[model samples]
Target: MGNTDKFEMIANIYDTPERIQIAKVSSDAIRECLVDAKSKNAIDFGCGTGLVGMNLLNDFKSILFLDTSQNMINQIKQKISSSNIQNAATLCFDFEKDSLSDLHADYIFMAQVLLHINDVELVLSRLYEVLKESGHLLIVDFDKNEKIVSDMVHNGFDQIELTEIMTKIGYRDIQSKTFYTGSKIFMGHDASLFILDSQK
Candidate 1:
């Protein structure tokens, strides 16, 4: 099965303790980069079961939980319904293939999502078009690691290389740092994660 199929199959059980902890840390990192965010609208791009977006509901006026898996979107919808979360919405979308021309946001953030994307630059450019002027795009993903090899996903990303791509895409104020390290995080090997902040 493809990666999207895998995510669909696991959506109902995706929020394991380890994943939740990682999401918490990722959200914390995203929070630190936020500035005057409460009044802004945001998109939790590639949000998986709303794990990261759930913790950030109060940080933005509204958060659109976007993912390619319908099941994952359904999982987040259930959470929104249960908690009466008025500020959260969900969208099942594949930016790589589809065009969402009318949709836009003040901020866009994704956690561990880029690694799954086949065309990183294309998706980033699509997101750039979707972001409002002066909007921010925050990314949380594992740093490059040679220990983990995968055909389905990128092993990880190089911050400098990623920054260069963002710069070429016209993003400014790009900054990134390794914020967290954990065992058995990327694949089965220990890995470090970085948080990157860039402006459109």
Candidate 2:
């Protein structure tokens, strides 16, 4: 939610072929890490247009598509309405600015969302509070990219450092892997993505 205005402006055209492909890969990576998900409810934090979360609807009992930009939430809402998806919902909320104490979930997965958060540890801890006991938090993001630089978003993340932060925040059974690589994915520089799985 760091660059809220940019995401709000691009919400209408966010679902490009490249992004769809990346979403598919990210969804697949998340699917592999799911266990007994059919009985669980999930939160797709920073869900952009519901691309990745839409692919995963059938895997979970319900999914809350959450984002900071209202336009992004509207886009996902339209998709849910047009498809008559019963198990999906959307919420336009920023974890950085506010906290939702009653919003609990069996699992929470954020695809390419962590990099947009300015205070990563604070957000991660907030998400940890929202999780049900023993719930899972799957994060799909880029491996640290030295070539790409920007003030709007993180260049990427280093998995080991991230794991340490999460571990410090009380996450366990953490595991991560680089799952996909694509051209000009991060700030016009070729980059690989990684998926990190941890339990609360």
Candidate 3:
């Protein structure tokens, strides 16, 4: 299935307690690396149901929740309406298809989203384009795993390899560290995740 259709099917069940807790963990990791956030614009590149992004609204001047699935964006909109949130908006957009040249951001956060993409380099290039000078990109994804296997998803990522790729894409001051591990966290098997923090 395409990214949109696959996420649309799971939008209803995305906010399970387990997922919410995990998202909190991820957001906390991202927050630790953020500096001067209150005056900046940030985009949650794959914000599903606004779990982490909404929690981070207080930190940024504006937060754009971007996702491939309209259904996922719908959930974010509902939360926005009920909570009377300000400085936050949802957009159903595909990173692969849409030109992000018009949208520049000081920070971008992607949690558990990159593994689903088949072309990592292309997406990273696009992210670099949209980032303002000296902007940061924080990516939360699984560390390399040998036990899990799937054609539709990357088994995991190698920190050194990813860093090399990011550097090649023109990112600077890149750093990565594993932050969380959970039982059956990914694909019904135990997994650990790393957060990659880099400057454009």
Candidate 4:
């Protein structure tokens, strides 16, 4: 199966305890980076089942959950309906094949999503375009790990290289730090997750 298909298959039960715990941390990280996001429009780019975004509804008044998988979008819709989450919305979107020219966000949160993307620079450039001036982009993903290699996913990333890419993409004040580590998280080996905060 492709990346979208594989995630779609797991949409129903994607919120495992470990994943939820990770999302909570990511939410907190975003909250810290964008302290006043409640007054801003937030986009949960590459959102999967709304775990990270939903947890952030209180912090961000309007949350747009965007994902490439329809099944993941369906699950987000279900969660919004069941929880009576009026401020949250879902969209089956893929920036790689769609346009974000009409939309802009003050805060863009991406958690555990970049490793699956093959063209990191292209994706970041699109995300930069979708952000409003002075907007904050929060990214939570695995740091470089040789033990977690995969054909369908990345082995993780180097923080310095990622920062350089963000700089080249016109983002200023870039910062990246590893905030979480877990065993058997990335391809059955211990992995550390880094949070990158960049200002547009």
- Give the per-residue lDDT digits (tens) of candidate 2, residues 29-83: 9999999999999999999899999999999999999999999999988899998
| Best by the lDDT measure | 2
Worst ten in a row by lDDT for model 1? 1-10
- TM-score, structure 4 vs. true: 0.96
- Give the poorly placed runs of model 4, Cα more than 4 Å off: none
Cα lDDT of model 3 by residue, 1-200, tens digit: 13667889999888988899889999999999999999999999989898999889999999999998999999999999899998998888887775766899999999988998878988988999999999999999999899987977898899999999999999999999999999998999999989999999
Best first by TM-score, ranked: 2, 1, 3, 4
lDDT of 1 by residue, 1-200 (tens): 12899999999998899999999999999999999999999999999898898999999999999998999999998999998999988888899897689999999999999999998988999999999999999999999998888999999999999999999999999999999999998888999999999998
Candidate 1 regions with alpha-carbon error over 4 angstroms: none
**With candidate 3 superimposed using the best TM-score fit, by how many Å does residue 192's alpha carbon deviate from the native?**
0.5
Order of candidate numbers by lDDT, starting with the best: 2, 1, 3, 4
User: Candidate 4 residues 70-163, lDDT tens each?
Assistant: 9999999998999888898878878766567898999998998998887888889999999999998899999999876589998888999999
Q: How displaced is residue 96 in candidate 1, in Å?
A: 0.5
After superposition on all C-alphas, the RMSD of every candidate to the true structure, in Å, is 1.2, 0.6, 1.1, 1.4
Check candidate 3 and list the clashing pairs. Answer: none
Per-residue lDDT, model 2, residue 71, is 95
Clashes of each: 0, 0, 0, 0
Candidate 2 — which residues are off by over 4 angstroms? none
Comparing 2 and 4 on TM-score, the stronger one: 2
